[model samples]
Target: MTSHSAPKLAWTYENRLLLILFMTFGFVFFDRLALSFLFPLMSAELHLTNAQLGMVSSALSLTWALSGAATGAWSDARGTRKPLLIAAVLGFSICSALSGLVAGFVSLIAFRALMGIAEGPVLPLSQSLMVESSTPSRRGMNMGLLQGSAAGLLGAMIGPPVVIGMATAYGWREAFYVSCIPGLLIAFCIWRWVREVPPGGVRHAQAEGAATQAAGGTTVSRWALLKERNILLCVLISCCFLTWFVVIISFAPVFLVENRHLSPSGMGVVMTCLGAAWVLWGFAVPAISDRIGRKPTMIAFALIAAVCPIVLIHGDSVWALGTLVFVTYTGLGCFTLFMATIPAETVRPRAIAGALGLIMGAGELMGGFVAPTVAGFAADKYGLQFAMWMSAVGAILACVLSFALVETAPAVLRRRALACAAARLDTQNVGGR
Candidate 1:
């Protein structure tokens, strides 16, 4: 009998886990961003105002912010991530499908609010799981790719045209319905493949295991988590990132078509390049940063992101525009990598999910609420070009603020210790004990 070597699996169980993570994120990107591509079609059919449209978008963000804390806390207490992930997916998918059915602004906004409520918990829970699942040796690479796939790469780029085509063929509602199919599939996959690990370390799959005790219920309060200055600083830094992120993603296509005189196809291509650049950074940079340390890379990215907008606003050529897009996406991608590291550095084992909920919810609210509407008003009063340029200025502010954040790398432990000390002193004095 001839013995044959066992067929080597192309992807180990671990690699398959990464693929599942990527797919989950891909659905999120598609669901969230497809709205922007469908916006024009919806506007034309419903004859909506910019404010009304912005309101609809804002509704989702607002609910996300509102519900995030509760959702995160609940997930942490339950010690299971699958429930939250599955619920978020189903809620968003159902609401997204319902969004297609709405005939008026009021109905659409209500459904969006429902979607936001569901959408809120996903990031913190998913990410906490991803990081825990990863070997510390490769955490940054895993994180960077996760952010890149979901935020920068396929979600924003490929989604636009797909949504656009569906809208063109069937109507805006049909487009949303089509988008819903993929998310449902993804939710099922996550249910089957993804397992929730405890935040502090590895945990048990059954009731009476060592891992279970290792991940036992956290005693930390939400108030205590917020009191950590490093965490707060991270949140403050994220505000800037969120502002720029929302402004660009929400308004870029509109600006390209209205201000730059690009055809829909042309605008789509520009956005595609921009999205692709982000993906490249997500895939390439964070992994490298894991080796070099998160702080130096974050600071460098912030500084560069600050400059990218200025270049993007003034450039006229297609090549120049493409170059600017790449630069901007790179900076944005770096900011994302920075954001992912905060919980790893700040939150204790038990409270990671809650911390993430607070951070993401707050950032999403500010970004969705203040940035885009202000940009829209600016576009109405001044021009789309000016609005975009102004948003870039906001990005620069975010960069400047990011300088204050303690680096997430292990080398920055001294700084973190110092910050914690200063924070403790401030609190002690403030308490008047």
Candidate 2:
């Protein structure tokens, strides 16, 4: 894999970078979810209240949004990513480890916020890199694996068990201490293996930039990005989808145990279904989009997403509910399209990272910061089902909004172009005959 001729090097480089980025994002999520996974132990030990927990989560999200946007813009302007990415991995890992040392609520908030600051740029930076390196045909799938599958498997599915098991055996603090190890290893891998951008990617990006410039897009400031319809729709979609995601993740377990009167074991099983669905559709939806086009895939998956919250409310029998949830929980795949793939395809090559960061920041601010508070308030005032219904509303809005999106899938667009060319040629031949 390492030694190859130029033609083969592109392939090798693409795979190597994909594998590393996959692991990189996986560790990012692993570290990111550590707080929630260890919250019970930390809450008990620090005597923290529900209000403190919300504040703590919001603190991280606030910094995450700001840092993602700022860091992305910085990298795009400077024309660099590797060093920043390496620093981000190291920074977040250390911060996650520091979580074990927190004495009280304030310290926890400080470390989590620091962690978010470091972790924020990882998505846009990694995605921009992925977009550059990948072949046009595989872009959707590569980004899907990097963003969806990796996070779903490492963070959502396997993370809780490992964290809880370690906390149970040693202590939650000890679990945090050990969490830094994976990030350190992943950072080392990136430092050694990754390139700033591949030769093909650089050329491809140049070609893309030429096309954009010819289309009268000379520069891609954040404000300029907003002027593009696809970027605007993607940002709004991010907000709504984040609401769908955050509310479900935040309240699902408690809602099951308390509101639905499901036993603890039953609730755990239902949540497990969510983790499974997150992993399965994470890559599947985007890969399918590669063939069918991003618009149809997005609309169809979002329609599926709307049904998941309702299924949670009314679904009966552990086996039946898990199946229903898994089937309907198709939003993770759509996330890759809207959050990374759509933006990358729509914007000029230079501003890929900034566009991603802006959408992410806006989404996190609404879904991560504001939505939770509002959902929690509704839950307290009414009931947890109110939060579930709110999630459904978010998904439905995202579906409706997706109708306005222009087709961005390379394969689909290429097909249309070829068909148009054929039609033009046929008309010319008939006139000549």
Best by TM-score: 2
Alpha carbon lDDT at 56, candidate 1 = 70
Error of 1 at 128 (Å): 1.1
lDDT of 2 by residue, 374-410 (tens): 8777777788898899999999999999999999888
Q: For every model shown, what is its TM-score relative to the native structure? A: 0.85, 0.91
Write one digit per residue (lDDT tens) for candidate 1, span 207-299: 333354677743457678768876776676667677767767777776666667777676677777777787787767776666666656766
Clashing pairs in 2: none
**For model 1, what is the alpha-carbon lDDT of residue 328?**
61
Candidates' C-alpha lDDT: 0.69, 0.86
